[model samples]
Target: MARIPGRNPWLAWPAGIVCAAVVATLAWLALPMVPVVVAWVGESLRTATSPPVAAPVEPSRAPLLEIAESDDAIDCRRLYPDDLWVELAWRPEALLSQDFSAPSTSVASLTDALAPQVRVTCRWRFDGGGGISSTLARVASDSAAVVEAALQGEGFSCETAGAVLRCRRAQGGAVEEHAVSGDLWLSSVETGRVPEDYGARLAEGLWGAG
Candidate 1:
């Protein structure tokens, strides 16, 4: 094979390929890194020049006057003495009240939901400041059936007249049970000393008051 007059074929071809490869490598390293270098330099300048940031503030909460009571029973401790106390005396002014200034007062409070309704079981002397202990119970309600059953079962002769459960113990004393609504029972239990027909008056106030 004869060579052409001004042509060095192998040298020319290889020189061109080397130049292309070098250009490609430089482009690969420089072009993609340009934006990244510029961003880093700008961020560094901004960080060095910018002011310090302040911390965020938190919101304040409102103050409470009293703690809330649980929804269970009507806790007497949480309530005022008067709120829990209600008239339980018989026709207070009839005979007892006429004789005594304050009368052997009858007051009642309710209990927890487990033992629902009002329960009145005590003989308190209001004048002597010796009243029954606070019993957190529901309001008393008079149900003839409930009253009759409870009294009869306890060996007492009982009858439900109107909204009252009247029970006479074998020995003496009157047990007058009254109610406002539901099955709540407020009983005016007396061993003795308490005059007869007094419970009827005491029970009158409680009956249907709910």
Candidate 2:
């Protein structure tokens, strides 16, 4: 028989297998990379178009006091000269009543009422009579209105210069006063002198009782 060129079958088989394996490996690696590239592009678009988030708001540190309609009255006490203590009761009716006595009369009445039992004496000093009168007038004209408005708006009322009491309605039928002072002008709701908080506490007690 005549000699004839023969095919290199060994070489051809190895080369075909190698090409298929390389293609399969590249596809496995590229499949995961495709989604990652798409996600990066989407995030870049969102960052460019979307608005920034707002900052968080801070809360207030001051205390909150609330009074309800059912509250009716409160009683507050204060220390006086000669180791005496004065107690004053404040009622809504008393505050709003036309028949309630003036500060001078209230002072005398309170002193009389509390004297024997508490063994304490009280005297009213109308030293700055005109000042007191003017202060009372200003307070009377604006006090209730101011208080109501403030309570409605801020849930509490405060008079820094005239009085330091913070007024709020208690859970009961009373209003309350806290941190009271004497330098301010307040009509005596009850007899004797009281600290500013007296009014606030009286309000709270009265409201609680009511």
Candidate 3:
């Protein structure tokens, strides 16, 4: 009987060697592009997840000023200089009752200090409840800012004239004016007869014409 033909184990070795060589060649050829592929993938992920840049915002504007560090000693005589009394149309010395008072504290008080104090307060009355009350107060730079902000919040129209900040408001028969210059805060309230250019004259008296 003829012996059955046997398969050759040696023939399988060449196929295996050829397959391994092909795999090694493919791996070597792709090695140079590995870093570039990895970098591209990482960049894509970063761009997708990164937050958008915010728009630039403009800063708010405030009045330019320099406040006094020391307390200002103000009196009615100094605040209402010569000719101002007549300009206000208040009677000379006959019928008007006048009052002037200054702060008792020796130290200067800020406009927004915890224990705020006024430099001086004055009142002139021609008849019962027909008069003007005024005050001069000291302030620091920061406190002056607070004062201006407060006046604006109270619906007072404000404007800057030179280095002074002036604000005014009127309701019924009462008119109010507030002015700031250097380290001084001057305020006046009038009831009954309102004078023409009263606030302007008062500020001019305190700050001396703009």
Q: RMSD per prediction, one decimal?
A: 19.2, 16.0, 15.5
* TM-score computed on alpha carbons, candidate 3: 0.53
lDDT of each structure?
0.41, 0.35, 0.64
Q: Candidate 1: minimum summed lDDT over ten consecutive residues — where?
A: 61-70
Please give, for residues 18-76, the per-residue lDDT of candidate 3 as tens digits.
Answer: 99999999999999999999999999999899998889988532211122223444455
- lDDT (10s digit) by residue, model 1, range 42-111: 9999999999788887743211102111234333222222222334343233222111111121321112
lDDT of 1: 0.41
- Taking the tens digit of each residue's C-alpha lDDT, what string does model 2 give over 26-97? 999899799899999999999999999888988432221121111332122221211222221221112211
Error of 3 at 78 (Å): 2.3
Model 3 pairs whose backbones collide: none
Candidate 3, residue 61: the lDDT equals 25
Tell me the TM-score of model 2. Answer: 0.25
Which segments of candidate 3 are over 4 A away from where they belong? Answer: 1-74, 87-115
Angstrom error of the Cα, residue 102, model 1: value is 23
Q: What ordering of candidates by lDDT runs from best to worst?
A: 3, 1, 2
Error of 3 at 208 (Å): 2.1
